[model samples]
Target: MAEQQRLLGGRYLLKEKVGTGGMATVFRAQDQVLNRAVAVKIMLPQYAGDPTFAARFKQEAQAAAALQSPYIVGVYDWGKDGDTYYIVMELLHGTDLKSGVRSHGALDPKKVAQIGSQICGALSIAHKHEIIHRDIKPQNIMVQPDGNIKVMDFGIARAKNSHLTQDNNVLGTAHYVSPEQTRGQELGPTSDIYSLGVVMYECATGRVPFDGDDAISVALKQVNELPVPPSQINANVDGDLERIILKCMEKDPANRFQTADELRQVLNSYLAGRAVDVPEPTRVIAGMAGAGGTEAMRMGDKTQTMVRPTAPGDTASNPVIRPNNQINTSSYDNEKHGMGKGKIAAIAIAIVAFVAIAIFAVSGFLNGGDQKSVPNLLGMGQEAAVASIKSSGFEPGNVNQSYNDQYSEGQVCEQTPDGGKTAAAGSKIDIVISKGPKPIDQVEVPDLSNASDLDEAKKIIENAGLTVGSTTQEANDADEGKIVDQSPKAGEKVDKGSKVDIVVSSGPETDSVPGVVGKTESDATNTLSNAGFSVNVESGGTSDTYAKGYVMKQSPTGTAKKGSTVTIYISEGKDTSSDEVDVDSLGLTGMTAEDAEEAIANAGLKYDPRQQSSSSVEVGNVIKYSPGGKQPAGTVIILYISTGPSE
Candidate 1:
């Protein structure tokens, strides 16, 4: 339903719808408070009333808020007004990792490792917090234009300390779900690692590790089927890299990398061109959990957002509870609240009289107006305190941060009133937390198409809240220093501390060589130059025996090694003529053959060099002038001086 398009809490203005999910519709918005663009996710009417889903959604965004990494998306706000429940998140400006994989097809092995390593890094942070992301798929990951990978979507997951249900049979996306998820078994950090391995396989081969006619079929394969090695489909995939990917797809969760950190280290070694430690496959035993008494879950009234506690932190580990105050219980009922103010007000006034006179009293009655008690905000950050305080019955006062010795920085160190203390309605509460405030955003870096440039890639990673790790290189046509690969495989969801590997390209190689005989001179020179050959031209002989300018001969007919010089003989046209012959050598008509020979010799003409019989000259020299063939000047004219004979 379209309502007023007013700013959300006078901070973010909803602009346009961007996407839709199982329970929420996402919109693009302008954050008026931060003066930045942001994403706003609103719960659909269908899911808004679902207390379970709503709580999980809120928890997801809130939990994500505690992480700070370049490989995760940031959460800004989450709240409800009337039937509208919405969340504000960071707006990304680049294509998601799935987009990169689709556009580039299967990536090279080096590149897959580059991206996979980063994902492992991001997962480490969440693993450290005991948070297991049940859903780890390509669509949930992002690849920034600057070559960084960022993982997204943390709702419907659970933290170790959370009391959420683990008995439900909600399998993650069919393609990336681990075998345990399909079997409805207890999942751990390894579940996410397994899913990430599937993603890496997809990136390297351009296809997910498993596919079937339906979710069941796909899930069955995850549990029982072995995937073909990535290199079998993509020729560029390296053998060792393929092994790492297969290790990730082990049917048993225990066989897979136990933690994100474990995966990161192995991927690290792979990117470094070193051997990696492959984890043993996980083994499964059905019905491993013994039947025991479970903590009772109390269903609170619709008006109360808080659920009954399932026994506070296991005291053994939490010996240092803030002794000041902590109200772990504040149950509320609905029927009495529906009655008019008269009946409840009378009861509240009577209860108020019980307090000491020095303290101010609130007139609001037992109409259930004072059901919620403010949680002790000491040692909490201003933001955390504001959230806690506002959720309770009190307004958050001007929050100021200060240094504290007992508590960490930005933690709620102290509050105005202790927990369980009765206060007037709407009283502002002051709180201070430790100054060691941790960063709240974890943005997965974007998929960099290739080695764009080490520095450019680094900038993108840094912008995503990630740090750079080792870099590798090989030959490529790309510009020098351009990044050609990354780990995390683009779009693998992760938190902070993910180390992204960068692979750049060094240009092509150069050389020179020989071979030229059946080949022409141009062909020869070209060959030489190609093989790093040099050239020089020269004249051969006056015979012009070979065609002019043709390579009469090269110093070396073949084997023109690099830096070798070979001169070639070139034709310089005809070099002889018949102009010097004396045609008037008239010896007495046939006086004597000897005299005729002497006369022909005087004509600058020589006897036929190659012998042949001639009928005209009558055994003597003077043959009738029959200059049938005309040649250039200084030509040797054989006058058939009688001595010419057949060869």
Candidate 2:
């Protein structure tokens, strides 16, 4: 059967498959009961047959449904129709972060921080629910059309108290897994934080920190290797953002941001242009020393070697230290035969110190001396600043521009180091030139009068640095779908990013008017009112074919403007023709204004008309009348007329 013909749980009508994963296939489905579009995820047949996997799938739905956050995908419902287990979720419409990053390389530092902050929000909610989102990579983050993000695919996530444990094997992708995850250890929120750090790293540098030909190699790197700083890969990555990302990627869980919320706060601070105070990432040295006694190592500027002490009866590896043509060990061996142990140790220390001093002397000679003080560059012209840096024994580095309130345009506003700070000679000095004070954040509202349709109007609004607000349709003389009016009218100045509301033309306000002949007065009025037409009632000549309170005639019965009046005439009940008709037996229970007028005329009595707005009475109809019974000839009857509902 076609997907459109397949109805699951007798309510969801599958429309078409939208996506597929290793464990389940997602279909865009229509909810029959709610009449809304939803995404239905059905487990693959292979996984559905396994009782253990099936149970976990069900738990995934339960745990995800318990989480409620705008940054988190909403889980509507879950169930099993026969052997098929399915979950209904909110249908999303946007590309994933991984695809976005691949198409467009590394993002701006602020944008990366913004995306990371939103993911942190989602993680914060999940952590509060005791659920750890083991996988937090770009592939699992959806970049929405509005530039926000939604964390997706909590497939492997489980609550803390869940019976199932994934400690036996690694569960997430190797390139983004934490060290503890690679070791199959118990995971927590910080583990997710570690993965998030890797995600931000990839976003900032356009590539994962660790990648290899196989998963095993990558997993090993996750445990044993340290990631290069993001700034080293992308020059745009600032020091603050680099620290934040590195802190989240710390190998030790305790060293990472303690919680997702804590990380979000720091990110928010960075985005707001406030000072961020994150500690430098901890650096660890792996495979430094082996078992047994410590080894002595000596490192020069160009060559270094570590010699392990030889132990008796130990046959591990060689203990001798050697560097090509740099050091001679034959002299030590020849002198050791007659020399005491103390003498040999003293000789080794002297050799190490001599190598260090020689290397230092060579470095000083090449660089033209010791450390030099960085010169003051603030408020100096770009050319002057560069000349000063050269004269001060330093090289000019990256020269960037930024808006600064104190410094004039083209003048240096900032430098990496203070004027008196000591830096190595010939080191590069980075400076920031001023672009003057920031401009006011205001924009002129776009004129939407010439827009052809709503879509065009939206584009115009957005192009003008404004957002589209609520749109309303109103009957207008302009062509249908055209924008007839706009708020904050054209050319008006407003704060940038303000919303502009628009009114769309619905064309002429004409509709088919229903025929109400021979219907009760109340029924006829209601029919007209519901059709967006007001009703007006008038007395009609007596007619034997229709009852007293029934409509006998109507005007403009076909099409008419909405909210316009439709006139209806009611019968006077068989034209009694008696000069003094008995008012008590007049049968005017539901008589319209027209019916009442004819009846009063037939009974030889005059009526005075009175009109007022009413809520319970239809327009142009009679509400009530005085002189109900036993009225004499020429008696003036007061007839109350309804003028429709009040505003």
Which candidate wins on TM-score? 2
TM-score for each model: 0.45, 0.51
Q: Model 1, poorest ten-residue lDDT window?
A: 288-297
Global lDDT of model 2: 0.83
Question: Candidate 1's residue-wise lDDT over 359-403, tens digit each?
Answer: 333433433465445587765567777887877768877666666
**Candidate 2 Cα outliers beyond 4 Å, as residue runs:** 2-4, 166-168, 285-647
Candidate 1, RMSD to the unseen true structure: 26.9
Counted clashes in each candidate structure: 66, 2
The per-residue C-alpha lDDT of model 1 at residue 193 equals 83
Off by over 4 Å in 1: 1-4, 279-647
Against the reference, the lDDT scores of all candidates come to 0.66, 0.83
Tell me the deviation in Å of residue 287 in model 1. Answer: 17
lDDT of 2 by residue, 455-497 (tens): 9999999999887754556678788999998877899887787
Top lDDT: which candidate number? 2
